[model samples]
Target: MAATFRRAMDALYLLCVIVGCTALVLISAIIPWAVFTRYVLNSAASWPEPLAVLLTIVLTFIGAAAAYRLNLHMNVGYFADQLPQPFRKLLELLVQILMALIALFMIVWGESLVEVTWHNTIADFPFLSVGVTYLPIPIGGLCLLLFIVERIWLGIPPDPIPAHHEVAPFE
Candidate 1:
């Protein structure tokens, strides 16, 4: 059962990575186009800048969740590492609890925010709801919550396998 759950989560993690990377690439591409249209082409489109901002929000939240799952999120663990084994373990639990709390806060507040803004359309995009842009917050929070719960229950997985192109020292 645990193995099955982990496999499912691994798939979800891959999905997060795909979404985040795609958003990031889109942002990179669109920003340049926006700039080109404004300075070079002498005609700026209203949608690109706002669209880039929306994509940025998506990239940040989704990428952050993926980072957390991969244990790539930033932390100051030097002191924690120096502590005795038991103390280190306790500190780990404490940290996980705090993370869980933050995720919970995001879930509650983010949903409220989404609800409040759902009816309002974005200024530049008449058909799009402002709340749609805010979706990453709550969705990322839920993803983070799932990962935190899994960590609390089964502990963090080992580092992921390196990509094919990565150099191996012994090779």
Candidate 2:
């Protein structure tokens, strides 16, 4: 059971990475085209800028959730690390609880935000709902909540890939 759940999460993390990377690549390509069209071609393309902004939203929320699952999100851990073993453990648990609250907040508020804006459409892409663009907020929140549950229930899982390796600056 736990193994199955872990496998699902691993897949979700992979999906997030792929989507985020794709968005990044698209943004990279789109921006240059936008610049080229405006400067070199002397005819600006309107779609590129708006599309890149939308992709940035996807990248930010989805990528953040993946980072959180991997324990890669920013934190000030020096103080937490200095505590005694028992205290440290308690603090860690507290942090997780706080994170769960934050996730919940995101889910609830994000959904409301989506609902409120569902009828509205983007100026650049009239077919695209503003709410659709906001889907990542709640989706990322849900992913974060699941990861938190996994942490509390099973403890942190081993990273599928090593997080870091030593590299010489010029070698």
Candidate 3:
């Protein structure tokens, strides 16, 4: 069951990564074109800027969610590695707790920030709602929270290396 579930998660992450990468590539090409159009051609694309910002947020959050699932976040491993197995386990727990707290905070308070921004609706970009801009915060936060739960369930087995998994870059 665990293996099947893991496979499903890997598929989901892969799907999300593909979506994020495609969005980033398409949106990235637009900014330069938008710049050229406005400065060189004296014309503007109506949907480019707002769409770019929205796509950028979606791409970043989706990528981040996949990264969190893959254990791709930065960690201060130099000190943690020196500890004994039990100590390392304890440290991993502590770190997971910290991550959980951050996820909670993002979900709880990030809403209000977005609300205020939505209410204020900036200049020509009145359509650029803050609520939309911040949609990723809670989504990514929830995904991170779920990943931490999986990490906690998997537990720390003395070393960062998993028998099946390859060495991560920072390791």
Candidate 4:
């Protein structure tokens, strides 16, 4: 069941990437058009700038989620390596808990931000409001929280990592 749940999460992460990646390509293409129209033709494609900005916001959030799922977030493993086996497990748990708490706080704060944005629309890019732009914060927080929970589950006493890591004490 645990493996199945992980696979489901992996699939969801892949889906987010597929959508985000496609938008990223579209955004990259749009900026050139926006620039060309504004400079070469002396007119701006108003939607392009707003569209590009929107995609950038989405890309950042989705990327964070993907990195968290893949365990690619910035972490200091060398210091963790020096600790004794039992202590290492304890430290890992502590780190995961800290991450979880941080994510939770972000979620709360992000929700409030989103609420404010929804109520207050933008004037320049009025079509694209702050609520839409700030979505990454809450979404990323939720994703990172999930990953930290998974990590905590595996880092408990007796540690669920592979045998090789257990034997090496530093692996």
Q: In model 1, what is the error at residue 20, expressed in angstroms?
A: 0.4
lDDT for each residue of candidate 3 in 14-115, tens digit (9 for 90 to 100):
777787898899898989988988899999777678778778888877778777776675656998999999998898899889989998887777766677
For residues 30-143, write the lDDT of model 2, one tens digit per residue. Answer: 999999999999999999989999899889988888888888889899998899999998998998899999999989999999999999999999999999999989988898
Residues 45-126 of candidate 1: C-alpha lDDT, one tens digit per residue: 8889999999999988888988998789887889999999999999989989999999989889999999999999988998
How large is the C-alpha RMSD of every model relative to the true structure? 2.2, 2.7, 5.7, 6.9
Which 10 consecutive positions of candidate 2 have the poorest summed lDDT? 162-171
lDDT score at residue 130, model 4, on the 0-100 scale: 81
Cα RMSD of predicted structure 4: 6.9
What candidate 4 gets wrong by more than 4 Å, as runs, is 154-171
> Which of 3 and 4 is ahead in lDDT?
4
Candidate 1: regions farther than 4 A off: 163-171
In order of TM-score, best first, we have: 1, 2, 4, 3
Candidate 1 has an lDDT of 0.89
Error of 4 at 3 (Å): 2.9
Using TM-score as the measure, the top candidate is 1
Write down the TM-score of every candidate.
0.93, 0.91, 0.72, 0.77
Highest-lDDT candidate:
2
